[model samples]
Target: MIKFTLVLFVLVSGALFLFGSSASAQNGTLFFSPATGSFAQDDSFWVNVMVNTQGEDVNAVAAYFTYPEDKLEAREINTANSAMTLFAEKKYGQGRVEISGGKPTPGFSGIQQIASVLFRVKSSSGAATLTFASDSAVLTDAGNANILNLVASGKGAYVLKAKSSASSSPTPRPSSSVSPTPTTSSQPAPSSFPTSQPQFSLSDVRVDTITGESARIAWVTSEGANSVVEYGPNKEYAFIVLRGELAMEHQITLENLSPQTEYHFRVKGTNAADKELQSEDQVFTTGALQTQQGKEEKGIFGGRGLFIGGIIGAILMLLMLVMVIARKRGESSLFSQE
Candidate 1:
């Protein structure tokens, strides 16, 4: 036993010494690039990956790194996901990379690069966190087999955000220059308009479901104006009179409109003195309103069915209670007689 133990100790010590020498040889050797910071959305960025071999000839070695999806988009020449690319920075000697496309290794390892990968992030609403990693495969210029010194870094990008507008008003008429006469059917609707130069803009433009001979008109605006709608089936001048309003937006139900017919309308902004300005024309088509009435009727019928079902359930519960009470009473009488 003593002789066997002595032999084992010598072999273990020699192995430990060789391992220490290999680790120390890779010291003072490192590789990196200059771009290490946050980037904007929809922009391109690059990084260089290298290794320090302590003045030793390195060959046939591979490296890899990975970034977050939201932070960056990458493409390599030999990668499966062609949309991603590995940028070739001039600082490193020109060596083309061949991407190996396959299932990512466990823990997202296969997504890493042997050297470097380039990224192009698109517009995003929030910040994206990114990570990078690398691997060292067999270095074989002269039969040296030692892969170590794996390093990683992380960064982020900021994306712009968008929001919907808050205004809710009808569109105002164009300046008097745009509309010469804003009269309706030889008569003007009762309304007050801005005495100053009419400023007009449009927002919340949408189409509503037209039914029967009516359609609801609604919009949002910053200023109140005397609103008049000029509409016709074909010719531009063929017009009709809508009500007048001084509110920001006007919701008017156009009455006596033809079903399934296309019509165009232009809103007029008028002053007390009969000066008029018109907005750009808007067009829409009317549809049959019968479908809307049928839906309402179905809703009412469903509510009535629920009410009838509740009444029936109450009657059945009452009947059950009466039957239970009669049985208990009969059992008590029989017990007393016995």
Candidate 2:
């Protein structure tokens, strides 16, 4: 009995030790300002990309912005006076906007503005959503290793209203050249502009596989674009996976999930012309705790601990049974002699 007790105690202690050593990684946040707003046809506005270290220093960042090409157009990108000293911007086939930048000497800490983008509302009335391309946005430290546990809130939507006829009249030209130039050039009335917006879609969104601590999501896009997934315990979608490359079919794997917990996720992508597409929110529950136990068995004992534990337990049981039988036989013999 004592030997069995000792063996059980050791097994329990080892299991606890393994679990105690598992620690979660630290994290930060990246978001965009003006998360929601409204714009009129022919109106132009700016949005700022911001980052919060949540108390960590970041040296580099790359962000991809996507919008509706038929309803909205990116006029320009401005990074002047931002934390990033060096930066580059590019526009691709549809409506994809890519911005990569970094600071060398002193990394950024706390909340800071990364860049500003100017967008113009086209002659259509509808909703337009701006999103960051999956896997395309990343934050890195001085060593160039990605900072883990990043919370990205780079999704925002705006409603476009039809331009009022009274507001479309041309402003009187200034009598003097001293008058300041208009910030926006005059445009023809909305009636002359295109009436329809460009269309983009994502299909075949499915959860490929889900384990205790990881999941894989796959989908196909109507057009080639960069892939990204925003997922979390709920719809807030605090975590993101940016697959910085462009493709027609996209797959992303999310790791370090909790066992048997529920998670919500959605897909976002941008084509060459900067047109962005988003999937509807979906839910999935991770596998049971048995999956985690399998991981521990593989990691702690390297596929041998289970066999060894079973052998030890069997030996202890056998010894207890032999001792009981021996005691009974000895007692019987003594009685017969008396």
Per-candidate TM-scores read: 0.32, 0.41
Instruction: Please give the lDDT score at residue 30 for candidate 1.
Output: 27
lDDT of 1 at 24: 35
RMSD of 1: 28.3
lDDT computed for candidate 1:
0.45
* Candidate 1 segments whose C-alpha is farther than 4 A from its true place: 1-209, 220-222, 235-239, 271-275, 291-301, 304-319, 325-338
Against the true structure, candidate 2 reaches a TM-score of 0.41
- lDDT values for all models: 0.45, 0.69
Candidate 2: which stretches are off by over 4 Å?
1-26, 90-93, 148-152, 166-338
lDDT of each residue in 14-54, candidate 1, tens digit only: 33334323433332122333222345556666543433343
Candidate RMSDs in order: 28.3, 18.9
